[model samples]
Target: DAGVTQSPTHLIKTRGQQVTLRCSPISGHKSVSWYQQVLGQGPQFIFQYYEKEERGRGNFPDRFSARQFPNYSSELNVNALLLGDSALYLCASSPTAVYGYTFGSGTRLTVV
Candidate 1:
């Protein structure tokens, strides 16, 4: 049973570019969530998916979007990247919508 896995452990992008982050949840996990952790701040919830549907969304802008697959894997898309968007994007998963969420190491995105 692997925990949530995020891809491109690190990324470098320029302003106005777009980026896509990937995540694969643990086996048998139906729920996946995304968070953004800025330096010196907590991880901010970005999106939550259950059964391939968007269940909850954070206060991010419209440029942020995500989708879950039949296998419970998910992808986070960020359009029109900005320097402020640089952060460690994390993926979390759990058996249910409750506690027990296991998080990934995160994808550190740096914008220049």
Candidate 2:
């Protein structure tokens, strides 16, 4: 089976701009999670969607948002981007909410 895939593997934006990142989960996985990994740090959980409904959210600000499609794919959007938002955004997929998460390579966003 194919692993999770993310689009626009890299991006550059200025502060105050907005950006959207896309993700496609492995076939048959029903849960998707979004995470942000800053340099030299572990990925921080952002959002989780199950069955197309939001199941979990992290300590991120309102500038962050996400949605899951019926096909199990997902997208992460950030508004009013800031330099702090620059990081590698990851997409993870799992069959359920508990374990077995498979992650994508990530979309690297560089906020200048």
Candidate 3:
């Protein structure tokens, strides 16, 4: 009955480096989604995984990737990080087979 959980609540990275964020969905949830939120902007959908397969992705570059584990947990990875990549990386879960989500507090990422 727990809500979605994200790891490493905060992170600091340098430009050109890489970063990975983790998430664990709520119990009984089979769908997970990732989103990015800049300080003053709305959350942007990044990826959605349902039944361990990717079902949706946003406008992010190829450097952004993700995978869902057999346990339904998920990871989000970004390569060649850029200053603009600094933001809150959020994880959401839904019982919906398709879209609509409820997000976690997120792992705040800072790129210098």
Candidate 4:
């Protein structure tokens, strides 16, 4: 079975531009969560969606948003990107809340 996967692996953006990052969850999984990890820091939760419904969200700005599709894939959209927005965006999935999460390598966003 394929694990969670993210696209691009790396990204470059300018201030005020928008970027969309994609993620594919593991097979048979229904829960997908987004997290942002700054350099030298742990991944911080951004959003969580289960059954295509918003389950949880972290303390991030409105510029950061995401949605999970019917196919269990997800996309994170960030608008008005700032230099501070530059970070590794990780996607994690789990069979259920009781299970541990498996994370993707991440899309490294560099906002200049």
Q: Pick the candidate with the highest lDDT.
A: 2
RMSD values, in order shown: 0.7, 0.5, 1.1, 0.8
Model 1 agreement with the true structure over 29-112: per-residue lDDT tens digits? 999999999999999999999888898999999999999999999999999999999999999998887678999999999999
What lDDT score goes with residue 28 in model 3?
Answer: 76
Clashes, model 3: 0
Mark the regions of model 3 whose C-alpha exceeds 4 Å error after superposition: none
Mark the regions of model 4 whose C-alpha exceeds 4 Å error after superposition: none
User: Of the candidates numbered 1 and 2, which has the greater lDDT value?
Assistant: 2
Kindly give the stretch of ten consecutive residues in candidate 1 with the minimal lDDT sum.
93-102
TM-scores for candidates 1 onward, in order? 0.97, 0.98, 0.95, 0.97
lDDT of each: 0.95, 0.97, 0.92, 0.93
Give candidate 3's TM-score: 0.95
Which is the better candidate, 2 or 4, if ranked by TM-score? 2
Q: Lowest lDDT 10-mer window, candidate 2? A: 1-10
lDDT preference between candidates 3 and 4, better one: 4
Query: 1-112, model 4: which lDDT tens digit per residue?
Result: 8899999899899999999999999998899999999999999999999988889999999998899899999999999999999999999998885377999999999999
TM-score for predicted model 1 compared with the true structure = 0.97
Expressed as tens digits, the lDDT of each residue in 1-112 for candidate 2 is: 7799999899999999999999999999999999999999999999999999999999999999999998999999999999999999999999998699999999999999
